[model samples]
Target: MVWSALGILLSFALVTAVHCIFSIQMPSSLETVNGSCILIPCGFTIPQSLKESLKLPVSGIWRNGSRWFTGSTDIYNSSRKLNEIQGELLGDLLQKNCTSVLYNMGSKYSGTYYFRIETGFKYTFETPVQINVVDILPQPILSHARVSVKESTEVELTCTAPVPCPQQPPNLTWTPELGSITETLQTDETGSYTLSSVLRFVSSRSHHGESIKCLLQTQQHHSVSDHPCAITVLYAPKTQIEVNVSDPLYEGSNVTIFCSADANPEVTQIRWFREWRGNVSEINRTDLTFTMTKDRVGFYYCEAENIYGKQNSSKVSLNITEHSSEDGYDTLREGNSSTVKWLLGCCGAVLMLIILLTITLCFKRSRTRSMQGSNVNKSQIYVNFDKNFSNLQRESRDSECGVYSNVSNSQSKPASEAIYENSSI
Candidate 1:
């Protein structure tokens, strides 16, 4: 029974030894940044008899999708391996310790790595190790070059990322979507890279929403990283203006003048001035309305501006007229002048009529006197034959003649005077 117990104890110890040989512990899973170095901690426990004769596997050998070996493959090489397959490796593996290191780790190195230890008893134990490689470079960030700029102005763009792989600095390049890229530059110090690019080209409204990108490429493995920056082209503010003046404004009356302009990107400032005077005043509001004087008669204009640029509108003039005292004064002056002309014409016409009536009365009086003298001569010859009889007849006739002459004279005088007076007046 004691011999049986010894055999059973030996078998139990062998199984325990085999289990411990395959159960190798690594320093937690190794983690490293890409293009950097990482040391994979691997140590094993094996039965003393097998440890003396067992050979360590070559560094950097592929096993189950992982580069499993004593050390990293990128910097290490053994005479037996191809040049392309050689990688970095640490110092010689410890025979009794069964531990090794790896260096120059990269993203491709991330995976489960395993190694097999062959024993003289025909038993092979396989141990597994895990590794994780991380990209240390931060995600690319991009920003607008400027809010606004003038045409043909130079534009600047910036791209940044957390520096990764100090030993292998990255190269920077810029690609433009609409305009041509004039320059690309990178600033690197202590393993970090800040890439900047400038594009000097004419700008237009068509390029308002265009894009540009900055790309970073690692020297090793040609790994590519990129960030995009937008271009915002600045331009002069566009302005259109209208001018107006108050109507019915007299020469000396105060009148209001107005100036207005339309512009894009919102005009930051507006200035008002008269051409006659250098600058009347500057107005904060786009539309300016102010009481104007005759001095403001010259051309007036306005200026519109923003962060980008400035523009001015065409000048306008303000005209004023003099006011009259009363509405009827203008009309009355014209009426009085016309009345004076009419009175003078009427007086001349009356004088001409009086002269004509006097000439007609003289002609009639001379003709009547000649006719009376002829009648007196004929009667005197007849009266000489009978003196007494003639004398009596002549007296009677004279009395009748006197009565008739008086009546005729009175009627003719009143009628002639009445006609003359009516025409003169």
Candidate 2:
């Protein structure tokens, strides 16, 4: 009896080890993102011989910590939690394989989960699965400079956000239509990202009530956050102001002095003042056209202001000279003399240039002729040497004939006399 019991015990131990080795394996240790779903994939293999004999129910129970409760029986029966876990089970228990998917994962669902399998033979096996839950919140801020600007001017807007490392970054978007959108940028400091978008449009009365918004959407589901900021635009108009008057005004002559200004919104007011005469006048229009006298000659200026800004013209010196008939005639004669002098100077410069060019050409021609003469002299020297060589050749021929005649006379006196007589004849 003792021997039989030992054999049975050894057989049971071996069977248990084999079952454990073939148990289901979950690909990813459980992980969850806030407001997102988590999928737990389980895979297992059964021995071919026992495939038909062994009946493994696909039902599983998830427990947090040491609590052992059935997911289908306990949670499904409870009215409050039934809707939550029932959807997650999704008919995953009936299948032979131990694979499951959880949806609408919440922070409270974060913990360890255990699976329980029941065989037809009253044998039961259990395995543990661990899970981690993370929280990802959207935090975005806007930063920019504050300044006053006139109407129809442009402004800039910037947006920034933070990102967590080892976690997916969120998507950033801008609203209330501004300018072109910029690309996303990452920083060296962990868990941080920044983005800037420009808003360029003419500021007007309509824009005073408008606001710019920056939206951040976290990757964990569609959780979103928004940041909004306001803008104030100021307008003023005042550019340049100036004073002008016609020249030559007699003591009692009707002289007109005008004040003019340039502005975008159009100058609303123009005031004229004389420092020496202490005369002040308010010109409602842009141009101040009035009669002037010798008293209005010392110094004159104008001030211009508008909704945009304000400006003042520089003090202008106005001289009222005595009017005379010779004054007009003398001015014309002086203008004529100045023109004549300018013409004479221009003509003299042209004549000087022509004379210089003529001199340069004449010098180049003389140099070329001198070089030709030198080449001719070298050719003449070669001709003289050829004539001298011909004269020397004639002298040598005469010497050779004298020696031949002397040799013939010495050899035979009669023959020599005959040869000499025949030659002479």
Candidate 3:
């Protein structure tokens, strides 16, 4: 009997040791914005003796103050219908999960609080949780890839806001509506929740030097925004040329040509070219504007270049008219006079070209006909020589064979008569 009593005593001492090792698992401190809600994640383990003797309808209690039951105020109680603070316990105490939540938090609720579990035997956790409440919510963090990128490159930007209360996460939005946006809720190493929004798009030259921002709206309808992020885009130059002239392009008229370019970086160099008589040559002037002389009349264009690339502007025509000393030329020498002279000169040059082409064609045709006639005459002479040679050979053969021919001249006879009369036999 004594051995049995000693064994029971040893078992009781073992149960007490097990209970001393396990207390509670929870964060020591938490923070939240005023007029918002906060969630406290908590769990605890009880001793084997308490678990074996545990009763139904367990109670979870939270007290605010230095002492537990003496001077502390009951903020939340699972057993009672009414409490000081409006909250709900989300975890099941039977399963050792003690997670809870508090709503409509304010500076008055910022203090140390303790948790107690009543399961047949009342036990209070000595570890206390500290709550910090602030009047203003901090701004969300914004991040992105490289600020300066080439055109058509894919870009992604992210905006993250803290989620103090998982049930009520803050809404995130991007400024100017950049592109497709995706949202996700994530957890950090400290077990805090964060809501993030990612914006993705293809960059373009039009988006250069644009300010982008992220806005956040809290559960209490409080709005805040982060600093703007400025982007820089790099692209090739787009060049344009403009001409300034007050009067017609006469022989001594003054003309000014201007060149401009649009690019991410300023244009580093500009070049001018003149095309005349099917030949293109570079002009020595390099400034944005230059004066032209009569000798420079032709098709003019400018090329602008930057670090990325270069571009050429459309060509502009510059026509100069030669001044005539006649009275009529002086009377119509202003605006329409130079244009009329240019058109007349072009028409006369075209007419002269047509006349020269017609003369050349006639000379080639005459030379070709003369060569054909000469060839026909030479062919007839060779045929006559062949006929004469054949007649002489037939006469010599007749004389050697002592045969007399009735035809004296075979060359004068018809082809059929020659064949019959010139026979040797």
Strongest candidate by lDDT: 3
**Candidate 1: stretches off by over 4 Å:** 1-111, 114-170, 176-210, 216-227, 231-265, 268-271, 277-300, 305-425
Candidate 3, residues 315-375, lDDT tens digits: the string is 9998876556774656666757789989999999999999999999999999999999999
Model 1, residue 178: distance off in Å is: 14
Error of 3 at 202 (Å): 2.3
lDDT of 1 by residue, 214-329 (tens): 56555443323343445565566666556555566555445444544443456787777666556465445545566666655766677878776788877666776666666578
The best candidate by TM-score is: 3
> Can you write out model 2's per-residue Cα lDDT over 64-157, one digit (the tens) per residue?
5533544322222111354445434433333445555555567877776654544542222245567666775544666643434566777666
Ranking by lDDT: 3, 2, 1
Count of backbone collisions in candidate 3: 0
Candidate 1 CA-lDDT value: 0.55
Cα deviation at 377, candidate 1, in Å, is 99
**Better-scoring candidate (lDDT), 1 or 3:** 3
What are the Cα lDDT values of the candidates? Answer: 0.55, 0.57, 0.82
Q: In candidate 3, residue 200 scores what lDDT?
A: 90
Show the colliding residue pairs in model 3: none
Least accurate 10 contiguous residues by lDDT in model 2: 71-80
Q: Against the true structure, what is each candidate's TM-score?
A: 0.30, 0.29, 0.66
